[model samples]
Target: MRTILITGPGGSGRTTVAAATALRAAGEGTPTLVVGADRTDTLGAALGAATGPEPTRITPNLTAWRPDAAARFREDLTAFQTRAANVLDLLGASRLDAEELTPLPGAEELSLLRAVRDAALSERHELLVVDLPPTPRALDLLALPEELRRYLRRLLPPERQAARALRPVLGRLAGVPMPADWLYETAARWDVELAAVEAVLGDRRTAVRLVAEPGPAGADAVRTARLGLALRGLPTETLIANRVLPEAVPLHGLLAQQRKALAEWTDALPVSPVAHLGHDPRGADDLAALAVPGVNTGHPPVEWPVVDRTAEDGVLVWHVPLPGAIRDDLDLVRRGDEVVITVGGFRRIVALPSALRRCTVAGAALRDGELRLRFAPDPQLWPR
Candidate 1:
C-alpha cells in the first residue's frame, strides 16, 4: 500500500491540495482513500459529499473519512490507564480509577498517528492520502514511534542485575507484589505494535508532501520539517508552494513588495523541486489541477534504493546505497534516540531501528560516496 501524507502550516491549503490529489487519483480509476486528520469536514465538503465519522464514498474510486481523533485518544487513555492500574496493583498499591490517570499533552497526537497507521493498513484503499495536522503537530506525530519505543524499552525492563535483584527485596519490605514478568510482557506487546508502525513509516512507498506558501517563513518551516522527517527515516517526496499570486496582478506598492518577497523566497529555498499553485486549492477541480507531475501515473520524485543485508568478515553488515551524496559534506551524530545527518547542505534526522539502537556503533566509514555505519551486538542491551 502507498500512503501520501500532506502537511504544512495552517491556511497553506494542505487539505485542499490533499483533496485535489485524491480526486485526481480517483478520476483516473485509482482506489484512493483521503483521511481528514484535521478532525474537520473540510475535505469531505470540498468533494461535495456528506461528512461522517465512517468512510464515505465521495466518488467512484474515492473514499473520505474524518477520523475521530478525540475518540481514539480516549481509547488509548483507557488502555494506558488500565495497564498502569494493573502495574500498580501488582506492586500492592491502592486501587486507582481510570479517570484519575490524566494523559500527557502529546497523547492525543500519538493516538492520531496510530489511527493513521490503522487506516493506511486497511484493505479498503489502494492509495491513502492523509491530510495531516499543521507542521509542528505533524512532526510530533511522526516522531511518536521513536519516543514510544524508547519509553517502552526503559519501562518494560531495567538494565543490570542490580535492578532485578532489588525489585523482590523492595516489594517484600513494602508488602507489594512487584511482578516484573508482567511488565516485560506488556513491553513485548508494545514492541511488536511499534515495530509494525516503524516498518510502515520507514517504507519508501510512504511519501510526505510538505505544503508551504511562497515566503521566507514558509520556506524555513518546510526545510525544518524535511530534515525532521529524514531524521526519522520518513521519505519526503515533494514540496508544494501554495497561494502564489496570479501573474496578472497589477504592480502596486504592496503588490510589488509581495512579489519581490516571493521571488527571493523561491530562490533561497533548498535545491528541491517544488510545485507552485495559484491561491488556495479548494474543491475537486482545483486540486486536480495542482497534482504533481507524474503522480497520477505512480511515479514519485524521490526514489529510495533497496538495501542489501549480508554478513562480511564474520560480522553482519547491511549496505544502503545513498548515491550522489558527497562524502566531504556528510556529518553524523547519534543523539539519544535519533541519528542526525547532514549532507550536501541538507540535513535529515533518522530514528534508529530497534535492533541498531540497541547495538553499539562499532565504526563508521564513507567510501565511494556510500556512508557505512557498523553496529556490533550489545549483549547488555539486547532483549532477553
Candidate 2:
C-alpha cells in the first residue's frame, strides 16, 4: 500500500490538502483510507462530515477515520493494571479506573502509528492518506517507533529472558522479589508492535507530502522539516504550496510574495501548488476543486555507506546524506559504540556497525549535502 503522510506548519491547511488528495484518489477508482491525527476533528471538519472510531464512508471508494486515541490509551492502561493485579493487591494500591483515565502525552503519536500499520496490513486499501500533526510533531512521531524500540531493548534485554526460571532463585538471594513474567511479556509485545510500525513508515511506498502556504515563514518550516525527515531516513515526495493565489489574478502583496517563495522552492524541490479556494475548503465539492495529486512512489531510503581510505588516510569515511543540513549547525560526539549527531536543532543517536565499533572518530565534515565522518581504527579494539 502507498501511504502519503501530509503535514506542515500550523494553520497551513495540511488537513485540507490531505483530504483533497485522498478524495482525488478515490474518485479515480482506487480504494483509499484517510486517517487523521488531531485532538480535534480537523479532518472531519475539512471533509464536512463527522468521523470517529469506526470508518466513515465518504465516497464509494473513500473511507475516513479519526481513531479514538484516548480510548486506545485507556484500554492499554487497564490491561496493564489487570496484569499486575497481584502486585497491586500485595502493595494495597488502588487500580485506575478506565473511565477516569486519560491519554498522557505521546499517546496520540503511538495511536496514529498503530492506525497506519493496521490500515496498510489489512490489504483493503490501495492508498493511505495520513493527516499528520504539524511539522515538528510529525517528525517526532515518525522517529518514535525506532527510538522506543531501542529503549525497550535496553531496559528489558531479550537474552535475559532466557533465565526466566532462574529469576526466583536470583530474587531470593538478593532478598527482593524479581519482576513478574508479565512485565517482560508486555515489553516484548510492545517491541513487536513498534517494529511493525517502523517497517510501515520506512517502506518505499510511504512518503511525506509537505503542505505549506508559500511565504517566508513557510520556507523556514519546510527547510527545518526536510532536515529532520532526512535525519530519520524518510523521503519527502512533494511540497504542496497551500492556498496559492491564482496566476490569472494580478500579482501584488501576498500574491507577489507567494510567487517569489514558490519560485525558490520550485528551483530546488518538486512542488505542487494548490490554488486558493477563496474560503476555507469544505465538503466534497471544495476538495475536488483543489485537485491534489495522487500518492507518489517514494524515493529509496538513504544509505550510510562506509568508504575505505585505510591506505591513504588510514581512516574509513561514513557518508550520511543530509540534503538540507546547514554546515555550521552540525555537531556530533562518539559515545562508546554509538554516535549522537545533532543537525540544526534536531538530534539522533545512531549506533555504529560492528566494524565501525572498533574505530575511533578521526574527523567529520559536511560536504555537498552529505555529512562525512572519518573513523580511524582504534588500536585497543581493532585486530592488530
Candidate 3:
C-alpha cells in the first residue's frame, strides 16, 4: 500500500488536499483511506460527510477516519495500569479513573501513528492519505517511532530479558528487587508495536506530501520542514502550493509574492499548484474539481550510505541529504562508532558502517542540501 503523509504550516489547507487526493483515488476505482486527527470533524466537514473514530465511507471506494486521541489515550492508559496493578498495589496508589485521565501532550501523535500503522497493515486500502499536523509538529510526530524504539532498547535491552529466569536469583544475592516479569513483557510488547510503525514509515511506498500556501511565510516553513525531514531521510512526494491566486487577480503585490515562492519551490522539489477554490469545498464534487492529483507510485526509501573515496583522496565521505539545513544550526561529533548529528533542534545518533567505524572525522560541510562528512581511517586500525 502507498501512504501519502500530508502536512504544512497551520491553515495551509492540507486537510482539504488530503481529502481531495483520497477522493480522486477512489474515483479511479482504487481503495483509499483518508486519516486525520481532530477534536472535531474537520476532515468530515471537508468531505461533506460525517466521520468518527471508526472508518466511515465517504464515497464509493474511499473511507475516512478521524481517530479520537482522547478516547484511545484513556483506553491505553487504563490497560497499562491494569497490567501494572501489582506494582501500584505495592505502592498503595489508586488507579486513575477514565474521566480523570486527560490526553497528554504526545498522546495525539502516538494515536495518529497507531491509526496509520493499523490502516497500512490491514491491507484494505491501496492508498492511505494522512492529514497530519503542521510542519514542525508533524516532523517530530513522524520521527517518534524510531526515537522511542532507540530509547526502549537502551533502557531495557532485549539481551537483559534473556536473563529473566535468573533475575530473582540475582536480586536476592544483591539484596534488591528486580523488575517484575510484567515490566519486561510490557517493554517487549511496546517494542513490537513501535517496530511495526517504524517499518511502515521506512517503507518505500510511503512519502510525505507538503501543502503550503504560496507566500514568504510558507516558503520559510517548507524550508525548515525540508531540513528536518531530510535529516530523517524522509522522501517528499510533492510540494503542493495551495491557495494560489490566479495570474489575472487584481492584487499585484500578492501575485508577485506567490510567483516568487512558486519559483523557489520549483527549483527545490516537485511542485504542484492547486488553485484557490474561491470558497471552501462543499463535498465530493467540489473536492474532485480541485483535482489534487492521485498519489505517485513512490520512490525507494532514502538511505545515507558512506561513499568510499580512499583511492581518489584517501578519505571516506558520508553524504547526508539535508535539503534545507542551515550551517549555523548544524553540529556533528564522532563518538566511537556512531556520529551524533544535531540539525536545528533535532538530533540523532547514527551508528557508523563497519568500514567507517575505524575512521576519524576529518571535516564536514553542507552544500546543495547535502551534508558531506569527511573521514580519515585511523592508522592503527586501518587494514595494512
Clash counts for all predictions = 3, 0, 0
Off by over 4 Å in 2: 247-251, 378-384
The local lDDT score (0 to 100) that residue 221 gets in candidate 2 is 93
Candidate 3 clashing pairs?
Answer: none
Q: All models: lDDT?
A: 0.67, 0.90, 0.89
lDDT of 2 by residue, 203-315 (tens): 88888989999999999999899889889988888899989888677767777788888998998778988889899999999999995876655566667899999999899
Per-residue alpha-carbon lDDT of candidate 1 for residues 127-152, written as tens digits (9 for 90 to 100): 88888889878877777776788787
lDDT of 3 by residue, 195-239 (tens): 999888889999898999999999999988887887777888889
Lowest-lDDT window of 10 residues in candidate 2?
Answer: 293-302
Top lDDT: which candidate number? 2
Give the CA lDDT, 0 to 100, for residue 359 in model 2.
88
Better of 1 and 2 by TM-score: 2
Model 1 scores a TM of 0.68
Instruction: Report the candidate with higher lDDT, 1 versus 3.
Output: 3
